[model samples]
Target: MIRLLRLLFWILIGRPLVLIVLGLNVRNLKNLPLQGPAIVVANHNSHLDTFVLMTLFPLSRLHRLRPVAAADYFLKNRVLAWFTLNIVNMIPLDRTKVGKRGEDPLENCGKALAAGEILLVYPEGTRGATDSLAKFKGGVARLKEQFPEMPVVPVYMQGLSRALPKGEIALVPVVVDVFIGEPVAWAGNRQAFTQALQDSVTALAAAAPHPTWK
Candidate 1:
């Protein structure tokens, strides 16, 4: 029942809103992983980032795509927790209390990957200013450390901040550009790998056409 609801929500609302209402200009769509046990890393700018990334894949693969989100924010309320966990298919990570009480912050993430699910992660840890890339956190690198062979796909998005900037509820009609770069291989160390991932995203952002709007 939950799966059906999720499919219906994305098919009827999410896809149309993203693809039609707010146009997407995607390049190198082939770089995205068609299967799971992979990580899709991106620079964070707005809440729409997750929705846009998820829409890139077919609805048939919806169940296999899990966006790693902040547990405090998404699970703050019962209703939202239910919706996000069931409908959005999010894997929540408690950012504030990492490793507390013998809990592994990446436990759920690791489990998801072990189950052959693709993780959509915003390495920035949080949204940043419009049209700017912030320093990435080490969580993504650590996750990759566990599954060293798993491909880490880098993607960059523009115009999403203007469309649905942080702290705003309504979305403006802006054409979002998505650039998918080739997978960034492990650089033999977490620090190096994280830097490489950031570089890949930065390069993609550089390739994107500048937004015409302010």
Candidate 2:
């Protein structure tokens, strides 16, 4: 029942909002993973980033596409918690209790990957300035360390910040460009792997066509 509801929501609402109302110029769709135990990493800007990335895959595979989200923000309210957990199918990572005794922040993520689920991660940890790339956290690298063979795909999105800026509620119509780069491999060390992933995303961003907003 939950799966049906999720499919309906994305097919009826989420996809239309992202692919039509907002508009998406997706490049290199072939780079996306058709199966999982995979990680799709992108720069964080706005909340719409998750929805946009989810739309890249076929609705049938929506069940396997899990976005790694913060527990505090998404699960703060009961209504939102239920919706995100069930409808959006998010894997919540507790950012506040990272280093506490016996707390595994990436535990849920690990389980998801072990189950061959595709994880949509924002390596920036949190959203930053509009169209600006921030320093990536080491969480993704840690995940890669655990699953050395898993493919880490780098993606860059443009114009999402302008479409729905940080503090604004109403979404302005903006054409978003999505650039998917080749899969990044583990570089033997977490720091080097994280840096390589960041570099791949930066290069994709640099290749995106600049859009003029009136």
Candidate 3:
């Protein structure tokens, strides 16, 4: 019930509102995976990444999507905390602190996938200052190694940084484009797969249109 309502509210109201008010324009929706359990790995440009994905995907079906977020930042403030956990269904990930056994974020991601849920992980640990994509972390590779069967979908978002710039509140009206790339398969070597995954994500982002004017 909650999932359905959330999905309807997002698509019917939330997405339209953001689209019209913020001038958001998602170019390639067909590229996004509509079914199955897989990793929706995207480039980290701004905090808008989560909201954009949540808006783009079906909320009811997306109930199983666990967006892996940094515990320190998202869980710190009360507003961002509530928004991330309840609104976006983000899973808190300890990016800075190390847990017992030196567990990595991929372990938690694997658990989510094992439970039949899709994961949204930013290859870049933190948001970038510019629209250019950053170097991906090894967590994505680890997650692939843990779940070789799960497909990793590469995604690129344009003009998000201008729409909602880092350390800013006022949303500037801009056409944000989301490009979903094809699913990448795990070859053989774990290390090689990780590098390939990162490279693929970077290449996808490079292909997508960047913000020319805010």
Candidate 4:
């Protein structure tokens, strides 16, 4: 039922609806691992980023893709929470206070990756102030540290924030580009690996700022 609903949303609404606004350009499509359990890490600036990423992938993989989202934001509303859990395949992480289980939030992420699912994460922890990236948090590093064999793909999203900023509700039409960079190998040190991961994203952004609109 969840897969059917997601297929319907993507076919009837999600993909077609976004074409009216989003102009997605993915560079180095081959960079996306042909298989998973892999992790795609991107800079977070807007909620729209997740949709943009999913729309770019084939429907078959949609069911296999899981996004790590804020438990506080997506889970508060029962209706939205239901859709997020069932349709969106979100792994809700508690960014505020730890849950009663006291388990590491990233442990859930690792579990997903271990389960052969494609996981998407925002290492910045939250939306940034602008197009510029915020210093990456170490959670992503910890995940990679645990699953060193799983490839970490770096993706950079530019212009989505303008389409849907941190505080806005209404969607605005804007040309957005999704940059996919070659998988970056994790260095042993967490700090160094995070920095390298960040630089990979930066390179993708600099290489292709946006698609040429004609």
Candidate 5:
């Protein structure tokens, strides 16, 4: 089955390769809530961020975690689409209509969370500066508002962008650190919640081990 291959690839190859080869380190993993519906929000830097988080999760419950990805980008080709859906267990959002009511991007994600699936969403919408956080979008806020009961845990990582910065095929060995923070409390309005979420991620980034390169 594809699920078995995914598990094998990550457990046998992906996790070890990243953790050992790239020197990826994760912290505050104990902060992740067990036996509950929650979304993990992180800053998007490079592709490795997803793998680092994916490998760090409890393998037994990895099936319950879904990463919110860009439909337009990842699904652009047949092979990539198949890999993302089958192997990566990603839920795609049509970024073209992200905030549009006619095409609510999180429609599928909301349904997934309703079934108690864990989510990994990048609030910045897309990758940004490696050294600083970018402006976050309101999709995360809207989703939280719809599913107010589900907690959104803030996450931050460092050194991935330098390792595999956008467009470079060559991957440099870089020291990476992932910091998971406490769940964010909604601030009533969407705008307030958005700001609070970004702030939470920034706070967590303070703990990243500074990379010598980039």
Candidate 6:
């Protein structure tokens, strides 16, 4: 109910509101897989990355896809907390703690897969300032290991950083490009898996002609 309303609000009101004013050009809608338990991994840059990713699919799939987001940031505010958890159906990830030393949200992802749900995860533990991807964490590798059968799709989002930078609320009009690469095969080895994941995202990012920063 809440999810439906939010989706409608974003589509009819929110996205167009941005598009009318900012002139958002989101392309490559045909690339995303329509069904099954697949891990959609991407390079994280700004808060707008999720919104841009959401625009890649139709409103129907937007209801189906659940973006794996950080627990702290999303849950910080009351309105966003309710929307991300209940509306967006986001899988809450503990970004602060990781590996054996901290509480892992990867296990929850496994459970979601068992339930036959699509997941979106940012292999980069945190958001990056530059276009180049950072070293990917082992969680993605571990998830692949746990579910070797599932495909890991890599997507690259360009111009989102420019749309709404790290510390800014107002979104600037920018032509955002979303490149969806072919599904990456999972190798059994953790190191190898992580490397492959990183490589795919890097390749996708390279596909776009983003302005380089100092």
Name the best candidate (by lDDT).
Answer: 2
**Positional deviation of 11 in candidate 6, in angstroms?**
2.3
List TM-score per model, in order.
Answer: 0.95, 0.96, 0.84, 0.90, 0.93, 0.87
Per candidate, the number of residue pairs that clash is: 0, 0, 0, 0, 0, 0
lDDT of 3 by residue, 1-214 (tens): 6566666667777677567866655666777776556888887777878777767776556678788988998899999787677667778988655445655645666778888887888877788767455666677666777777778888777777888888988878777777777788886876777677777766666666653323
Evaluate model 2: give its lDDT. Answer: 0.90
Error of 3 at 136 (Å): 0.7
Q: How close to the true structure is residue 2 of candidate 3, measured as C-alpha lDDT?
A: 54
Q: Flag the better candidate by lDDT, 1 or 4.
A: 1
Residue range with the least summed lDDT across 10 consecutive positions in model 6: 21-30
Task: Write one digit per residue (lDDT tens) for candidate 6, span 1-214.
Answer: 7876877777786577455654554445555777757778888888767766665666777666778888898899999898788766788887666555647667678888777777888888678876467888878778777778888888877777888887889878877777788788876699998898888777776666663321
Per-residue alpha-carbon lDDT of candidate 1 for residues 98-166, written as tens digits (9 for 90 to 100)? 757876889899999999999999988888887567888888888898998899999989989899989
Question: Candidate 3's C-alpha lDDT?
Answer: 0.73
| RMSD, every candidate, angstroms | 2.1, 2.3, 3.1, 3.4, 2.3, 2.6
Runs of candidate 1 exceeding 4 Å displacement:
99-101, 211-214
The residue pairs found clashing in candidate 1 are none
How far is 34's C-alpha from truth in model 2 (Å)? 1.5
Q: Arrange candidates by lDDT, descending.
A: 2, 1, 5, 4, 6, 3
Pairs with steric clashes in candidate 6: none
Q: Which residue pairs in candidate 3 collide? A: none
The weakest ten consecutive residues by lDDT in model 4 span: 205-214
Quantify all predictions' global Cα lDDT against the true fold: 0.90, 0.90, 0.73, 0.81, 0.83, 0.75
Q: Which ten residues in a row have the lowest lDDT in candidate 3?
A: 205-214
- Please provide, for model 4 over 104-155, each residue's C-alpha lDDT reduced to its tens digit, 9 standing for 90 to 100: 7777788888889888888888788664778888777888888888899998
**Residue-level lDDT tens digits of model 2 in 60-154:** 78999999999999999999999999999999989877888988899999999999999999998888886468889899999999988899999
